[model samples]
Target: MTLKMSGFNIHIVFDLLAASLSLVGTYLAYTWRLRAANAMALGKLSTGYGIALVTGAAVGGYGLGSANLILSEIPMVGRSIVGALAGATLAIEIYKRFRGIVGSTGVIFVIGFTTTVAVGRIGCLLSGLEDQTHGIPTGASWGWDFGDGILRHPVQLYESTAMAVFLVGAVIALAVRSPFFLKNGFYLMVGFYAAQRFIWEFLKPYTSIAGPLNLFHFVCLSLIAYAIYMILRSKDART
Candidate 1:
């Protein structure tokens, strides 16, 4: 048997290819409108893809850190939250000065965030078994087995399914002719995805603090809270 290793990851052989695909996949979704809103406007697709690229890297850095595979050549704080805010603010200022367009909120969060999660999770799968994960064992054929005869749940599949459903719903809202759907569509997407993730996290094994307060689940709770807030705010805005 041959051992493959690159700083703690097994699939380091094709790692770069996976990341390249993620970036390109996000880029294509972003730029699919095929036309700009106006002459001076930056294409919505470009702006959305740009945001997804930045955010994707930020999340990837987290995975790298978890893997303990830090590369010294790369800037330590690059793609971080503070860095993103600073970079985006500066970019927006320059765009404003030069009469270039900024992406809309709907584009940034819905398309960008969903694409980021979809692409970013691939890294998690590549990283494999390191990041938090858990699932039931099935005697049925077709499931991932890892770590010396340990049968594990395919948590990533659960998340990917959630993202796919949300993406389809988002496309429908954006493309179909329906005012009611368009008006609250974004908030609805957030709420549904957040709720699904929150519930699914329970299936994974996690430490409990005072009962059901693990790290992953805790983050899910935050998303749930934000989803609720987004729904309420959207309703108020509509009224």
Candidate 2:
């Protein structure tokens, strides 16, 4: 029942699906950003800004992913979307500081990212144990056997469900034009996602970079910290 290429299998399908969703998300993000005052304000600066942000994020994501691949005995577990988020965030901030651009230019990406992850995880879940996103062994009826006989926590589902909830909340917040959401939506999403991912990492058997914390645990904490800092900064800026 498993599809294969070289030595890999059907997991590639989900991986491809994730990549496709990311592309879709990128397009949606670009279009949605056009409605933002900050986005429009970029004007002639858009080209350089776009290049800087993208290059930075891509470099950061690749660097971190490479670090994981080098350090871990496991294959696919090294790559993480969180690493990309962290990379992108860091790069964007550096670029902004260098160019003196301000305000949350990342707001438009919040929902788009959530949608991408939510859709992408579907592929991860379908990829099952081979994807290395599976949770620790669990006796619960809700657990999925994956390819193994032992039932395990469906961590992929847990993350996907959390993102789905956030997505719904984000949509509603936008519909109502909530001032707080409008002002600091990106920070809110990052903080919320970091919290959820931090919790879920406990279920994952990812190799610990430190004593008990995996590479992602540190990345998640960093994300949470950055989100908090950004949220507070935004609030202060408003006042």
Candidate 3:
């Protein structure tokens, strides 16, 4: 059902909250020695690597998101976190290859990225039908009515909860100094996010591109493959 909270838009509020929380989390992680100083150093925007990430994420987020909406015949702008991740991955890979950089430079962003998705999706849920991220109709007891009387799956919350669970696990892994997370946490997070997004796509009403799969299905699969390839090819894996 629609929330009757007057005045401010809940979606924008949550977006700000997500950003603030992500920044705080990143700062705490660095200050508390949860992430390596060197890795965090690489995240600096002054570096070319950071520029590539921002460029790729912006282009991909808008390009792919808008492409999906157009393909689905929806007359509105869109943005996809999945697209941003994929774009950033491609950009960073190219930069690393040219600069002879190796291993994952994305470990510093794993928690912050996860935190954004986990918290930002609540805004989507509250934005109601205008957000265009609602799930297909469902008969489940927990289904919500987003302005329209039809009970839908509330996939936004489902995704948010899933990422929140992952965030908890990631925090614990960091706290314990898990070697796997220290070396390959970025790949792990990408793979997990793609896997979950792939599943959630089935519950969405987006237009199908291949039989029953939508544009995001292919994107998710590509991300999963990318993550796997990177993890397998990592120097840590060889050692």
Candidate 4:
């Protein structure tokens, strides 16, 4: 579909808002009556994001660029962050309601974050990156010419496939309602994604902000730590 509505191309905003509203609504329904649906977590996630956005905008504005940059070149950042919070919140609530024992409460946050990245990055691809240096260079017969033969990997599709796999695994795992998933699902998917994103980073072109704390390596390390923490905590909780 064309990525324009009227003249303003706010695909990222709409996607984030739509996905968050839809998923949160689904979750509320799943809980039956849409009551006590982690209003606090929702507020906290929004507040956290607001803080990040404001801080980032301030930095950008200081650098002579508008704060809009933080909200640009991204797909569903606001929406997915909220969704992640919702997922994590619902996870703990679900665990309490069904299992009658507390499990790693934050696991769903990781899962939601990963899956949303995978699913929503397509929006980025659709809108196209404004930065010239962001993907693989190509000269083959089948290479796409995004105006400069910057034959980049379809990292979006790659991630989407991985995420679809992760989503299926998550649903199946949840259907079983096994405590193991409640503890380990977040880490497993995140750990796998860390490696995948790390490799994809090489194929990806570097950005002006591509420093030691760039996207690929950063996501990898963070997820690995989260995975390890969840598993370790789950084990400890059992004991």
Q: Which candidate number maximizes lDDT?
A: 3
Task: Write one digit per residue (lDDT tens) for candidate 2, span 1-239.
Answer: 22223214455665676667767765654465435533543343567677876776677666776676556665443557787788878877887888887777777677778877787776777776666677898878898877658788888788889999998898777766677877788899999999999999888776787888887888899999999999999889878
Model 3 segments more than 4 A misplaced: 5-8, 34-46, 235-237
Best-fitting candidate, scored by TM-score: 3
lDDT of 4 by residue, 161-214 (tens): 776677677666666665576556656765666666666666665432455334
Residue clash pairs of candidate 2: none
Q: How many residue pairs clash in each candidate?
A: 1, 0, 1, 2
Q: What is the TM-score of each candidate against the true structure?
A: 0.57, 0.83, 0.93, 0.57
TM-score of 2: 0.83
Show model 1 residue runs off by greater than 4 Å.
1-104, 134-142, 177-186
Measured over all alpha carbons after superposition, the RMSD of each candidate to the real structure, in angstroms, is: 7.7, 3.5, 2.1, 8.5
Candidate 2 lDDT score relative to the true structure: 0.75
What is the descending TM-score order? 3, 2, 1, 4
Clashing pairs in 4: 134-205, 135-205
Query: In model 4, where is the ten-residue run with the lowest total lDDT?
Result: 60-69
- Clash pairs, model 3 backbone: 1-145
TM-score of 3: 0.93
Residue 129 in candidate 2, Cα distance off native in Å: 2.3
For 1-239, candidate 1 gives per-residue lDDT tens digits of 11122423533433455456546644554455312322133233355446654554456445433332223233333222212322343344344445543322333245555555555554444445543343556454545564435566566666766787787777665555345444444456555665676676566554444476444444445545655665576667757
